[model samples]
Target chain A: MEVKEPKRRIPLVGILSGMISVASHLFRKPVTVQYPEVRPYEPERFRFRISLKLDDCVGCTLCEQVCPNGSIKMEKLVRENPRNKRMLYPDVNFGTCTVCRNCEEICPTTAIYLTHEFETARTKNSFLYSPLELAMDEKEVKK
Target chain B: MNDQWIELNIGPQHPSMHGVLRLKAKLDGEIIRELEPVIGYLHRNAEKLCEMGFYCDNLIYFDRMDYVGAMNMEVGYLEAAEKILGVPPPDRAKWIRVIIAELSRIAAHLVWAGAYGLDLGMLTPFFYCFAEREKILTIFTEACGSRQETNYMSIGGVYQDFNDKIIQEIKDFLETFPKRLEEIYNLYVKNDVFLSRTKGIGVLSKEVAIAYGVTGPMLRASGVEYDVRRAEPYLFYDKVNFEIPISHKGDNLARFLVRFEEMRQSLRIIKQGLEKLPEGPYFNPKAKKSMMIRLRGDGEYYARTESSKGEFGVYIVADGGVKPYRVRVRSPTFKNLSILPVLSKDVMLADMIAISGSIDLVFGEIDR
Candidate 1:
């Protein structure tokens, strides 16, 4: 196909206006948040790391069954709830977890929940959370 | 096989090729003699992987398929899955899906515009377009949890409901977005360099586009007014009143104009959807629980949606089991990218980038 040259408009007017428009942005504050120092606010429903309520969990193993990636494994805990006979709580392997909130939604007693803990990266490859570790909040995870 | 003809490979990793697309072009001096698109560099085998998991597990994979337009991708898969189960989402949920999907289209177009500008060596508009895109991502974050790979849409309906805060934020966005859009449009469209670079750069004929199975904005840019939302009318698209912008020019500039107009149309659709927001449950009450577990189906179904890049479709074959027998994606980018060799033939080497960038190939969807 032959290349056709369209009717061209003068660049001077467009160039000056473009420069002025860009110059106007100079006064505005930079939108970037300082990482490792200032943390941005996450919304209430933000899905990040998984947490489980030890008391509320009935050990039905529904969360373990519902997990798509086989991240959740039902393990027997030493200090079990007296209400529960099975004494099995879900231990989530975060290395395999997709954080899709399938377990949180499928939980029978609102036990498994997702916290707004954005900083999930660590030195270790294995991020398996035991029943005790799963019960801790974001503040505790930071500690 | 001329003595001066040189072979050039422009990235599975280069800056301008868009995602992981590599163009193997035969160059006669600066003019391209032949061009072959080398795909599968970013392939994750999402189709085969979908068959391994439960029906619901495939939703996350859909999210990654078209990360820019995840809502549209999810909607396409869910539509196919819902067809097998013989249940549609509730009215409110349908409206919510329409609103969110349109928002995603605008967001996707914004990314395209920013990237296209960057490809053409204009840095100012990229930042401006992304700044506006950030506002849309913020709305997505508030409505659903995540911003870009938002697994917001579910099988029966949506995972979350729209609260008052989210609604208000959308309204605020609708109000401010037009001015920002105009600002960004003026930054580049009026500029002599952007106009000259893109105006007559890549001219795709109407017949060639249709024969190659091109759909969405690219097809519309070639003056083929075929949009899945208008033609097929999925979700609440039939209920909403919107226009499909078409340009007969069929050049890189025409594609840019068509996409920009599409963003405006998306804004219009969102406004209408929000205005006619119904009061009801977001999820289909009957299919909600059963769909999460073993959604056994005996037949095959195909579902297509007007995604940002083009017609994103999902074809599912189920065999009365927990897992799908087979899942195939009719990704529009794949079809849209097929015509690249045709368009790139005999064009200037520099203009090849403009043409390819205008086509908007997301390797995730194209290679999936």
Candidate 2:
């Protein structure tokens, strides 16, 4: 149907929108992003990257995972302790971390806390590094 | 304490305002006698960003310019770079590009459909539109990592390949979901209120539309059937079949109808694309690393395509270098909005909102 211009100005548009906005808004799904309160839904095998703890000093390869996508690679590093003893650390390569956050969650110690930071895209493939070399390591420490 | 000729400012802060859009209206008792649109509020200097970043890094920035049409924006720069390098996408990659581009086009139009209804004072359609749009976005996020500003489209092909779940989701979206959009039209198109507010308001004639270079649904609304998809076929567009919906009224309502009909045609195009889905490699990685192909030193080529809203064109000059010498984008909203003062001149202060809403300017694009 062709719409002809009406000479009469209608005033109910704002009101109609207001009423409908309120009514349908009730039936509408809430897309609110609740941070620090609860974790939102995560799909299984949602691949991102992995984060590892440097303080726990355990060379555990448990993250080789109850396995799915072959994205996890754990490397062992030897660092001398304050007692002049050899301590073992796990170096994680994120080029392979499916970002299931499994490594951070399953670690047996309080030495690691995964920060809620994401979206670090870069031009270089080297930036996909998830090592202590990548996961916010302290260079200029409390010496 | 108001005069017969009331001067009202319909703000860079009003609700109906699309990202800092300001309108100064001269009204004679709710009827607008004159209105002016003020631009530059959301201007973030996106063009300058092009000059600052490397050709590869700049794609990320272009995605944010009019983030809604991120893929189109990415393609715009990639094509300009391709023109400079003189490397063409393989037939398989081109078809994949066209298919995903059309999907993004549909996604962008769904936003317009829902939001236009919101602007017209109907709210239910927005949710319905988003409900359907979410399905498309979900499919996008699954295929690409991000939901909105997906850097999914690489210079040659997609950044990633499609999985079985994504393919099935897209096919299901193509089939099961658009039924909700039908329910929305049935409920609102005949509501009388939506029609009375929108019909015959802000009529852009064919001559004016052509003169202003108004492409897309707005131009089609004036009975000028020129779609970049058909007029200048690129990618796999030549391989598929679709129709451009045109209306003769050229009024706000006519533009609305044009887009509604267009969604139908887009669905047809998507269906055709799926049935004829040929198998092959999505991306030709070799298209990226070759520094041998460079654009002509002194030639200028203008590429225009039918975006969800209107014709989006990119004009780039080659200094015979890898990156463009000078790039200026002719965004659809930037041009379609120029006719605002003409349309709003004799409208009511309240009606000015409807008029501007019909024009559908995105500040990201307008400011860029």
Candidate 3:
């Protein structure tokens, strides 16, 4: 049995091409985005942490209904409003959230939305927020 | 006989194995006499997860199966669900899907090229390849929110519309990538050392490639013109004008060249798709947002899409329920990796790495 050697290319040509390719990029600016210091820009529509506009929430329970990961649950509030006796609002568990933003999109009142604040790392599971806490924060902002 | 043959196990942990592929090879001196590939370390029961969830809920699982080509993975599932429901995506959505899928192809190939170089003892191409892939990932993050594992494509349409910013970034990438690709070609593809290492090593004949059911660039390298995009045109693939790159050599170098040409062709498809992108709703208005997306009737449907790796297919059986009765994924990497033993036969120990790298295995999909 005879073994045929593979066809060879000119080493000079290959060497020059490799050298030239590397040399051209040697002087160009680096493509690395310096994080922490530079804080890479996230798009406006980028889904990160879930946020709620408590005033606009109609207690529809749509966010909870559409959440595939079961991250959002509609819980009845202690203080019932006269306008609607069924006072339910969303409590979000960030641990279970895949951030698919299905809840945000399904919210008919546009009360539920995803903010670009992805820095949600914490030492405790207490980072999870209930609708009451969200509404309280809204009230504080208004004040 | 036992003393003459050395049994070598190459890893579920080795870096060059390209995911958790463990190769058990029987070596006689420096030459591999027999090689058996042991896979399934990264299996996450992706198909089973899909079966338990609604059609919309399965997109994330598809993303995990082939993390390098998440958009294409999502496309496979979406197409399967669309087939079962008898729903067609909007015109704008189809074009957007094509653009996203082709970008993913480029990204996957970039990773392959980089890692293949690394396997063959070249380092610079890895950085250059990743640098370009980062730009593509940035586009993905802007469009779909996540860099990797983007469950962007839905059954009715895509998750979000392609805004002007994302379109502009894609255009910028299209313009700058060719020059970078040329540098990659020069750095690794045309390098003397790379050529010596890869050229003519692990030759798979066209007949053997077909017999082993190899697809994607691997099959194309063996002179087969069978591309899922060209053979069975899906999405806007038929509308676009691009040639399926093929090589006759059927060697490691041939596979590399085929992928190199494919990147160029993908750029062309993206350019054409962008130019002809229609102005309309990105998602179909009729497609319901609820998790319980009931199929029209009880039926079995299969949808195959040309993923970056190869023909990624989704098979679904519906029993008139929101969740599928059974969901099966036909991953390209699985089919492609099956040919490794034949390719590795009688090859030198060092050449085995070259052979494996050329195939471009993603164990996540294979295991799934």
Candidate 4:
């Protein structure tokens, strides 16, 4: 008669995985990074924060229109220059900003665009950006 | 005399399915004889749609491919379009993208871990996963206006910067998450029922996984060292010191284990990125040369990134026109999901759900 050999068992298969989860508790230096002191390395090309140079902007309102979630709005501005002529700048709402960069892409003069500095969190409800912060002239405009 | 074979018609809209998925199974009492998946229930023809719109317009459509990890999917496409446009975003933007992408990965895994638990009849873990996910999504909402399909990563960089308040929120989340993960894992992972249901079931050898073109946790479960973030470094992944979790078992349990480890690694990557945040321009200031962005007819390039699911590749073939001549999207869910029919054969009927969940198919991306 032929003898049937016994099947060898594979022992402790998923044991390491369970242990690794437990071992993580020990000697794991605080993985948390203190904000500001140890800031996240935002890439030079990261498209987080929105910054505007206003000088490169035109009154096309493409940025306002192309926004996916309607986060950006372009208000017509009347600026007093040397000749007392009127100029325009877009007023942005950080609260509603989707960060899709629709304004940056649609902007004719590239004045309104996304910035690599993605560090703009605020606790106050009234900290939204206005036309003055995004326009060439430092004066706030509501056109 | 009675027939032994039984024909089971699993409907197109099953609750256990990841998205819209249909399976036709042939059974012999409790054992499955064969299984066939009828896909494309939600096909939007994403590739063809991408060819019709402007480069920026296309990114929005691409974002919906992997809805669980929409931002990560969009970033790869956004980068591809910018690469072809011959514009390199500032390093600060790239670093921010990495931080957000890693965070997005954690968010996606949270959903997966929760949904997987729900599929396996473990109700508590799913809720726990979602509760933690809510915290992550809250941070995402502050950074990028919308909740789920956040169009956060921009063409040249991100939509906004991470201020002190948001950074502190991330810090709090990181410190609390590892403990949260342990709490949930201890409940479900080591449980005898959970292991019995997953262990030694739906086994896929490492060689078979490679043949199926499966990447991410599924491939890593089979002991393959191929992560797009590591092999082809994009953003600031190179600077983050972390290991790609892997397992030799190559079974349903291994896939679950791989995702668990990846989540831990994601926290490490996020911490590294947060520490290295730079101060610079988030948007490009160069003057626009034209309203319409034309394409080059000379050469075609393929851009891919390691999304939460797996690899998302965008192949853009331009003919020197604003619209692409042809576009092909290689979604990881579509590729990773096809392995189901092969594994489902000869497996028990109850175990089929575990196997299918382990494959992690999102029909939206698969059909697209």
Candidate 5:
């Protein structure tokens, strides 16, 4: 690594160009989107809160095993499926979840998926979704 | 020791400061005499946690390590893990990794540019830079599931393939970003105030930078033609043709120019990568689920990737077990930050903010 001499540029020209750049943007449409009324574009794979489909779940326990932060815990559920012998489903603790998508990736079935709902805030301190609560569809999760 | 010296502490909380960095500076008549960076505020003991989990489970920690450049961080860790496992990702995956890594570099640089502007008492550029960054984040969201902490890269390959929609999105970004980048560049770089605040400020000499183990754009700005992507030739970097931009100034202005040039190079790399992207399976399916859960390897390997900040290297000491025996991260910001004391001497108190911002300190990576 060797040092070379620095280049000299006209400060006046730079300032004028910068001013022109800023001025040009004044005529263009503002990039900011008004929230609550105008929703920003979220891609198809936009991940946020965890949603579970009880009908497709088979109590594989893979989601629980793959959760890095212990956010997902397997609980005994009364609902039984032909594939599920133990009748277990995942209970997601959103308070600890980093939304890393590990559980979704490891799931044997596409039962556990991430919803595109960005607004997961609640008045309560912690968000603990039980087996039945986690089974909410996209529409219910949105609500 | 002199009574004339006044001790000042600027953040673990401050509006202008980047992240949760706390700077303890000793000032004498508005000039900084001595400075020490107080870290560990954002520490999660990530290295220690990596030792407790399975190999695949630890990738998320890398995502959090450098949250802005999560893709690059993941690449570093996975490269080392894959080396030990002796399973290489498919050609398409390698190309995809390159594209994602370069995009992350651009995004991280955009943040640094924005935050740097904000530190220098300019607000408009911050908004402008972030607006540009939002588009890149959308690309990440489409490729991975998350935007900032994208846990996209996986061992033996990436988690998902780039769909045509995602490719089109990237192409759209590529088509529009350069012109927008020029506008943003002209908005700040050529401005009299920005230049005066940055030029010839916090000059890190070549010897001092090398001595302090500085890497990435900081090192490049000091006239070091070293890039891990080029030097190590990881993935498809050797296949791509791009110049390593360097400046001998080693000052804040030089760093800004270097980063701007690097972004252009990154755009070129992404364009080339998209063109050369092969058609194949993204992941090496041979690396089974059981293998991922309980990976057993007996070796120590260190892999380095040029993150947006600098060289984000990961050292893994694996035993014949499910978990790694030890994982050590060579986070670039940590080493780059070590030179703060060297650069801060005899500089104005206000200039201290400019200097620190130029270094692009991320406490998550540093404190980890």
Candidate 6:
């Protein structure tokens, strides 16, 4: 029986090749998009924060049912709708939302949809958006 | 004179252990005498979660299982559901799914390349690999909204259609990615230090790999040409022309080379898919819009996709109900990780990391 040692090959050329290849990248522009300073453009269909179309609400409770994480809660409103006499609207807990867009796709009256506003950083969980804030935003947009 | 052996615990906490993998190795002067692996740290009861949700809702949970290759994970479950419901996706949808799945395969392999380099104390390749991966992730974000953990694929088809801009971006990626891949090969695979560390270490024989049920690059590197894409021919894989790279050595270096070639093959598939993409409705119009889809019949079915890690399989037993009666996920990482003890036996302690890195275990899938 013969015992053989694995052949040892010199790695000088290989090391030099790798070094040169990486060095070439230094001359190219950096790919980093500096956060907070520069906001990357969000696509049209991008699922970010959720928003409500207050006037179009039919109190379907479909968004609440479709949310996989139970992030949407429907509450009874004191003031009723002028046409449909609907009194229920949704309050969203943004903390648990996976942003899968199920609620948006499943909304019959198109009352709920994802907004382009993805930045939801807040100091407290209570500061997260509810139906009231969403309605206020919708009013401001209309004006 | 007396001989003594020391016991060492590698981690459920060590950074290089990949993810929550604990290895108990008995060492005799830096050479491992025995190795035992402990897993199940990141388990979130994936099967049980699947049973609770509607079939469509379970896609979100599958995304979390193999977080790196979420598209591939979703494909496994979607195929299973599609089979059970007797719903074949539209032709256009099938091509789109192939393109997205291959891009995900490239991204997942890039992660492995970066982490494997990190495990070997090389920092340059990690940065290089991630720089390319960022491009793929950006494309994913543009197409699917979320960059990671995207539940984009539904039972009937994809959630949305790719617009011209998205398709053009993919073309741009396809054009630029091959040169970047060559740069990666020069940076890591061709480097002598990498070859020295990985060339002949942790060799698994073809017979052993097959017996242990190791699929994907690991099995291919061991000289077994068992690719589920070629064998099972899912999606438009049969239409694409590509070769399965194989190495007879079955060592760490062979595994690295196999993945290196696999990235090229995935790029080839993407190019063909883009060229032959037809215009049609992305989703099946007859498919119901409800979140809870009710199955028409009660049956048991299994679907497997050739994921970047290995063969990811979903087995569902439906009792003609909205929720499945039983669901089981056969994760590739779990099977690949099982052979660690066999590969690590009698190897130097330093070589252990290389061997484990070659397997590319994602603990989220393994534990689940």
Which is the leading candidate under lDDT? Answer: 5
Provide DockQ values for all models, in the order shown.
Answer: 0.38, 0.06, 0.31, 0.06, 0.50, 0.34
lDDT of 6 by residue, B163-238 (tens): 9989898999999989988888767766778888998899999999999999889998898888899899888889
Comparing candidate 3 with candidate 6, which one achieves the higher DockQ? Answer: 6
Error of 5 at B157 (Å): 1.2
User: Can you write out model 5's per-residue Cα lDDT over B41-108, one digit (the tens) per residue?
Assistant: 89899999999887888999998888877788989999888887678899999999999999999999
Q: Write the per-residue lDDT of candidate 4 for residues B271-342, one digit (tens) a residue.
A: 998899899987554313233243333247688899988888888777777667788888898888788888
Whose DockQ is higher: candidate 2's or candidate 3's?
3
Candidate 1 segments whose C-alpha is farther than 4 A from its true place = A1-8, A82-84, A123-125, B289-291
Q: What tier of docking accuracy does candidate 2 attain?
A: incorrect
Candidate order (TM-score): 5, 1, 6, 3, 2, 4
i-RMS of candidate 4: 11.5
Model 2, chain B only, scores a TM-score of: 0.93
> B31 in model 5: Cα distance from truth in Å?
0.6
Per-model TM-score on C-alpha atoms: 0.95, 0.75, 0.91, 0.75, 0.95, 0.94
Candidate 1 on B47-148: residue-level lDDT in tens?
888888877778888888888777889889988988886667898999999999899989889999999988889887888888888888888888878888
Against the true structure, candidate 5 reaches a TM-score of 0.95
Tell me the TM-score of candidate 2's A chain: 0.45
At residue B215, what lDDT does model 1 achieve?
A: 89
Task: Give all candidates' CA lDDT scores.
Answer: 0.84, 0.65, 0.82, 0.73, 0.86, 0.83
| Decreasing DockQ order of the candidates | 5, 1, 6, 3, 2, 4
Residue by residue across B71-106, what tens digits does model 2's lDDT show? 767776666655555556666666556667777777
Question: Which pairs clash in the backbone of model 1?
Answer: none
lDDT of 6: 0.83
lDDT of 4: 0.73
